[model samples]
Target chain A: MLGHLPYALAAWLILWGLYGIVTSRNLIHLVICLAVLQTSTYLILLAIGYKAGAVAPIYADMPAGTVAVDPVVQALMLTDIVVEATVVALLLAIAVQAHERGGSLDPARLCALKG
Target chain B: MLAPWPVALPLVAAAFLAGLGDKLPRRLADAIAIGAAAITALCCALLLAGPPVVYWFGGIQPRSGTAIGIDFAIDANGAGLAVLSSLLILAALFFSLKYFDKPAHMFQVLLLVFLAGLCGFSLTGDLFDLFVFFEVMSAAAFGLCAYKSREVGPLQGAINFAVTNTAGAFITLSGIALLYSRTGALNLSHMHRMIAGHDDSLVLAAAALVCTGFLVKAAIVPFQFWLADAHAAAPTPACIVFSGAMVEAGLYAVARLQGALFGLPQLRTPLLAAGVATCLVGAVMCFAQRHLKRLLAFSTIAHAGVILCGIAVLEPGGLSGAGLYVVGHGLVKAALFLCAGMLLHRLQSIDELALHGRGREVPWVGVLFALGGLLLAGAPPTAMFFGDGAIHHALEAHPIARFAVTVASIATGAAVLRACGRIFLGLGPREPDAPGGGEQDEEPETEAAPIPWSMWVPAAFLLALAIGSAWLPREHAGSAAARMLDAHSWATQVLDRAQPAMPSPPPEEPLAKGLAHAALTVGLAIALALLTLFRKRLPEILRGPVRAVWNPLAGSLRALHTGAVGDQVAWLTLGVAALGASLVFS
Candidate 1:
């Protein structure tokens, strides 16, 4: 049960973030919730990259013999982090515009384009 | 290296255009955007002359027969899609020359960026790379949708689009991570080679999540509320690309991923159901719309559903037919949207009811508009006609789908015909005293501003190509379909050279039955149109019953699309959960 703790936490985090998005009244909160949901992916990647008794993957005349955690997953997570930043920045900008134009960040008030 | 150019050239040009900024002469910016798009189109065309070209980025070829490097494996279908996107982008740029009030360099840059995203998504073989390119494409689209951010409507629409699609991207990323956790492979071919013989729950979960992500982007029902708003709010040129190529890319990703990795057997039933539901919903909502752009957007949703059905059949005939349909529909839809854009720019209103009899003066555009409508409706000698036939042939084994096929075909045709009648034929009320008269237009009604040649040429050119493809001999069409459906060859070339030679090809179906199917569909469409146009003339008893049945249903459907960001996010999450449930149960 303890070994599964990370997975449990990741799943909970994603669902919690989704709940925040569902109930949040402000656009800023929604963007932050999105970032939180995206962090679950980072956590999963880090978990997959882990190895018991593994050393850093830098091979510059390091320890004579050492197992290494997967470096590729780390690279992927880094890239994902960058993408998350870009997405959040853009969403925040749009949210700011929404607040300015609609006079409210509440989605309930933003119905100018509805059927 | 050369294979990557189609995807890279546009990005390079986009950066250069951004640097040049608004100070760059308007014509120079136009020239740069168009030139880059043309070259990229040329590159994709050149790739078709050879076998699949596989490129390894950063000179990091797979080590020890394991795919550790990012690979771009371009098959014939991929090449075909790349050419379609770039060509459409080219046409969009050409039409935008005089469309916008001012020359916005950012618009040109965004178009190039969008082109690159489509090209990259088409050619890349890495799952994560596909995700990256998908984001790039979608982000660019969000920008273009809100390009006129000074307007409240476009900004709201863009927010809804961005928020929902971001959630979709996260779901897709999580799926990729899940698959990586299980198989430790990001390259689709490598993943396939590793997981081919297994039927694990983890794999099912990943597939479902990935598929849901793409389906959301494709605007499949239950996840499609964003499309109509986004298309209606976006500039016409951008709408052309969004409707013409972006949604198709989403469908292509779904099929490509399933074909390369999961082989399409487990998820067929659910996908087929989704396809039918999407088709029915889109068609129903399409006719209910008053805005021309929204109507076109819904039609795109319907066509996406039809293509999904063809794809869900998961046979050579179905896949080939889907390819032809996508190409044909893309061109037809682009022309229609361009014509709609012309009307919007010139008349300043897209309300079909208000625009009745207003377009009769532009006879040439009227002709193009009529042809576009006919092509979309699967008229004879249109590529869609034969493509629809192919889809019918594929559904031969699924008897239950006959009703779905017939209703979808008729509804799709009727939607276009309905728009044509309201816009051009003046079939609706002839209220000459309508408040928003066409005479008090944005441009001077005194001079009757001459329509730009740039706009008409692209619409006509695309219309001719869409219909002209029908003239190809039957044998050529058959061979092209066979080549596209040669999945064994695609797998070997893209995944592993050591795989065995492809088995014998499936027997080709005759086109005669398809023609019969088209005839029945078009006839039903005409009947439906007449019924709609003369509904007021019907007996009071029948009219009352019809309204009773439809009014409440359409009301609820519209209510579901509340245009609130939070509601859209909720639906997206619900969609993901439903997909998960389907994976587990199936």
Candidate 2:
């Protein structure tokens, strides 16, 4: 139960980040909040896959062929991290361009694009 | 070996084109895109000829009924989508040859990546892998949306698209994590096998979250505002792909998930309600649009809602209807958008009211646009007629829902007729005296060239396919439906046998129902539209109390959308917390 604390904490961080993203008026802050949310999700995913008393996945002193935490979730988390980074970078670029053109990062002024 | 190439080929082509496409000749880059899509289409055709195959990566295998390796599986549905994607890409590329200016290579590269991501999204067997592909597709779409950075609308549209879509991705990923925690498997089929009868509310919450991501992508109601703006702001060829094929990826995800994960009875009601609301909202929104491209965008959303209704039914016929609608709508919408692009190129504006009576300037384009409009209205000898008819007929088994779908289809048809009337029939502000006066009016200073055959050929081919698919014999249609059903294994087989052994229905059933509905709805719509067309009556109708009631609702909704970043974030955050709470509680 104590070991699962990290997973709960990660989930909480995700919620908090989501709160920040929703309440913040700045585009940069929203992007940052999204990144934080993404990080928290990845952490939660990785934490869920961890097993008690399990050594590092790769270690010389570990029991030979002993079962460890599932590797699938770890791989998924890593891929997700890469995906998140790419998405965040792209979002940041778009936000920067929007700011340059509109002179305001407030989404209220961005209505120039809507139907 | 051929299995993975359908996805990998395009990815490689995308990378190569991005790196060196700009330096290369425009023709060469276009050729590469066409070649890659052609190969992918061929691969899909070959796959369709065989039974479903699962290709495992890294040599991992299922142990104790758990899938430990990544898998890409191809069944009838996937093959059908592959074909649809390839065909749309081919058409977009064909049209882009003359439509675009410089930087042709970058456009082609992004197109290839978009294709690759779509294929990956359709074929991947793991939930997390689906997320990966979803991100790939969304990111590529965002890039394509902003590719025309010289334009302010495209830049702003791309920003809004990125934020909304990114938030959606996060929600989807969170759902995946939760599902993984409950089931301890990533493979979708394995998860299905494991969770089939398990009454875990957590899975339901995850399903809702996962579905929200696709819903946003699909541009269903409440999430549809972004679609019109994005579609209107995108480059013509990009709009073709965006409206034509990209949004379908979202519907595809929802359909696939419903088929695999949420087959339980409890989930069907909410799904159907959402589908119904989307259909109604989309249809109404279509009537409210003034821009040709934006009207098509809303119409596309309406049809997507119809397809969702088909999916909500969860019957074999319903699934087949949805499949048919997806393919049919993709082709017809692409053609419509491509035609709209040509019209816009010639006229430099998208307002139908502004471009009234300009159709005759480009005679062939005018003719094609009219035909495309007919198809959009689901006239006989179009695939949408059969697909939509089947959905309406299937809904007949549920008496209460049938009226709603019938009304929605009628509204959809009427919306198309309204646009067609304005663009093709109404008198314009500046009527050109000559048959070829469009060229003179458009660019009087420069010599006008003939509309390119490259553009006409693809649009004609797609229209032909749409007509031909509709004209296919009922038995052949049944066989195609059978292929979709065959994927469900025993349930499908049992249902097949249990189906009533009455004499086969005539091929004209769908045609008859569609025509009847179209006539009734179009007649009513025209009557109402005619009344509104008289400006004096419009003002009288809008006077005093009527105006008072309408203003506040519009103002409130408009206020809700007041371009405030905080408000958008607040909604996003509220949605996330609501979803997260649902996950935890339900």
Candidate closest to the true structure, highest lDDT: 1
Tens digit of lDDT per residue, candidate 2, span B251-339?
Answer: 87887776665565555566566677667666666655566776787778888778877777766566667777777878888888877
For each candidate, the DockQ is 0.53, 0.48
Models 1 onward score TM values of 0.94, 0.87
Positional deviation of B413 in candidate 1, in angstroms? 2.0
Worst window of 10 by summed lDDT in candidate 1 chain B: B437-446
Report the error of model 1 at residue B457, Å: 1.1
For the second chain, the TM-scores of the candidates in order are: 0.93, 0.85
Candidate with the greatest DockQ versus the true structure: 1
Q: Which digits, one per residue and each the tens of the lDDT, describe model 1 over residues B299-388? A: 899888888888888776777677777888888999999888778766666777677778776767777877777667778776677777
Model 2: per-residue Cα lDDT over A1-115, one tens digit each: 8877887787688778767876766778888888887887778787778887775576577777876787777787778888878888888887788777667676656554332
- How much is B495 displaced in model 2, in angstroms? 23
How does the DockQ of candidate 1 come out?
Answer: 0.53
